[model samples]
Target: MDKNAATDAAAETPTQDTAQEPPLAGRVALVAGATRGAGRALAVELGRAGATVYVTGRTTRERASEVGRTTETIEETGELVTAAGGTGIAVPTDHLDEDQVRTLVGRIEREQGRLDILVNDLWGGEHLLVGSVFGKRSWETPLADGLRILELGVRSHVITAALALPLLVRSDAPLHVEVTDGTAAFNRRYRENLYYDLAKNAPIRIAFGLGEELKEYGGMAVAVTPGFLRSEQMLAHFGVTEENWRDVIARQPDFAIAESPHYLARAVAALAADPARASRWNGKSTSSGELARVYGVRDVDGSRPDALAYFEEVRFSGKPGTPDDYR
Candidate 1:
């Protein structure tokens, strides 16, 4: 379905049963990189749970951030969060800068008094520079370019997390989430992209390291990934509209089964609601499908797009495909 169709369908559906629950009422959350994609969705989901959310990102109406591609802005995300039933604050920030990140958190502390959740969704430009791919080597692209990607993808998250730690530690049920892509064990050079692989891997390690470090403070840290995210940017890249997203399955069969950002957002909400969630997911990296099973919540379409299972089944069954085979 296209965005309009989905919106209309949502309008027709009954109100969510959890609308009255307010699992996170009286809580404050900070979602870094909330301008678009997973970060934006997570902020809205947290809001649905009844938490005051601070949505920070570099992209704004006045000026665009490092990544030139445009979608929603932090202000737009904040509005969505507020519409979901919580107060939303949009703060323009570039996470790559340590001082900016610190200031962002300091302002949150001043306004909210305490932080309950922190989600680091910063990503470098690996996916953005798809044109640079040459043969099996990502390094063949450029040295300086790769380093720049590292700064945004890896360093930004580190800096933001460092600045937010003190405030997170002060919260009664502190939760930290590092967002990344895919699983660690499934690591196959990923189209032979060296910097991209490392940047993605680093977040998982950060989660594990922070999980151990925060043990003393009774805090939890974990990494989360979405399966085949059908993001607005990705749909535009593929020349497909959400209404006809299934059309891309012909080009990449796995694309047929895509999950919306809301799927992962629900996962974060479930984790925040669970009192024992820290013990279960601390230091671990999990996927949206896995979280759906654990939380018993459906995706926006009310279907569980189990991308992992689809991959496994295809691999075992030896499905035949080409760029347009699944179409």
Candidate 2:
């Protein structure tokens, strides 16, 4: 829901050893909250697979959203997707507004006739995490900030899915993805703050319910989470660029396993391309690391960084091991 870099190499449609065509050559996808981070990368990756991707978010070159950052915009995401060899349309949308979401779905239906993929990656609450969620109890947190997180993370996804599903169900192999912060298993424990926990868990439930409802239509829905993501904002927080990200690992050992936003994009793209994805992943809650292992996807650096494994085996379990052990 939130980072952005699309490499030229990544833009080129990846060909398999068998000389297969781009898997999604004639497909259409809508990536909500694609202004930056994982959402932006997912749009670009889908384009690389030859899907015409509609990239939507509140940030644009002409206007900034409450997120307040001007560095990444939906227009730039659209351009990146186009550069990746698929048509990219930038739509400025506030998903919390039902009318706006309806208009978006109508426009998509008018232009594309059907939607193959619907990605709800709408969270933009990183700015509110520090003081509002990290160390506060549910009641101790500022009511407005906590409510805003729910608005961005929960309500937005619901609105988008409700409006978009009608068009999505028309596709032959519709795939709905709910992008959240943690896998359902990992999130069984409290995610620091009560509001934040609920915000993240809601998507998983939404995906499950949608999956069940879509079964009759031959559609698939799954919730996915990226492992210790090396988002643009995360890099800045560590005072390092991606090129020199390792320099800060000594200060934050867990950063050693941080993965690029592209990893999650690759997972979703793989899901979109798989013919048997419904059987493989429908109604499931998975992480990028798990998908990467199953689909043989590697990070941009060519390593499969399993942040969940690292946390479960070493960080949380008190095992004697380094990030290298899991990655």
Candidate 3:
């Protein structure tokens, strides 16, 4: 289905329930940087599971951030979450500003009393990937651009977790999801750019260190990555729409294993709803494909695309196989 059709269907009738009550009924969640992509989907899925979600981002209907895209806004994300069956509150926040983060957390605490899930998905450095970052040595890259990437992808996550954890720990079952570009194992090799490498890997360590700290309070922290994600920005990059993304596979063969942002969003919702997530996932790094398999969840198109496995066994390894074999 198209995005609108899915939203209309969800708004008219909730489909995330198989029991008497939605799994996350009455829970409260904060999805940081939910203006678009996986973060936006995460907010909506959490709402579908019956959790009140506070979605934050730098972009609002009134303004756009440095990422430069104005088509999507946090206000629209908030509406989508509410339409999906939970309370959605859009809060404009620049996590790098500690004061803004502190106020955001304070408002959540005042309005909800406690936070059940914290999803740190605040990276917005993709615009730096082309001329500014890629194919350059650390010495060759622009210092300002490199630092901006770290500020957006790494420091923001740290700031959000630091300010939000006090309220998050108060919940009976708290989940902290550090969303990043690649899994710990996958990122062992250099990511072609020094700054990008550090930016992505930092979240994995954040989850590990936070897990150690949060365990004492009965909270779980895990790093999660999505496969070749077909995000809105990515679709635009490939010059295709979600409904016709297959047309680009001929030029970009690896795109065959691409999964929708909703795949990772569902994985996060499953993690939030799982009673034993602390024992099973705390301090570990995982991917949407791995979680989907564990939770028996499928993507919107009804397939579980394991892009990492495909890359490791086929693309990088030069094994003779098609993306279909992995997807």
Best by lDDT: 3
lDDT of 2 at 190: 91
TM-score, prediction 1: 0.88
Query: Which runs in model 3 stand beyond 4 Å of their true positions?
Result: 1-15
Best-to-worst order by TM-score is 3, 2, 1
Q: Write the per-residue lDDT of candidate 1 for residues 1-327, one digit (tens) a residue.
A: 567756664565334576376888999999988888888999999998889999998888777776775566888899999998878899998887778888888899888889989999987374546656434376486787677767877999889888899989998778999998866654443635677777788898999999998888888899988878888788887898778888887777768678889988987888888999988999998888888878865578756666655554464456654322211
The order by descending lDDT is 3, 2, 1
Please provide, for model 2 over 1-327, each residue's C-alpha lDDT reduced to its tens digit, 9 standing for 90 to 100. 012223433333244433666888999999999998899999999998889999999989999998888889999999999998788999999999999999999999999899999999999999999977799999999999999999999999999998999899999888999999888889888999988999999999999999999999999899999999998888888889989999988889899999999998987898889899999999999999999888777788767789988898798889899888766
What is the total number of backbone clashes in candidate 3?
Answer: 0
Per-residue C-alpha lDDT of model 3 across residues 1-327, encoded as one tens digit per residue: 566755553454325546578899999999999999999999999998999999999999899999999999999999999998888999999999999999999999998899989999999889999998999999899999999999999999999999999899998877899999889899988999999999999999999999999998888899999999999999999999989999999999889999999999988898888899999999999999899888867788767789998998888889999888876
Off by over 4 Å in 1: 1-21, 124-128, 133-138, 188-191, 316-327
When summed lDDT is taken over every stretch of 10 residues in candidate 2, the lowest stretch is: 1-10
What lDDT, from 0 to 1, does candidate 2 have? Answer: 0.90
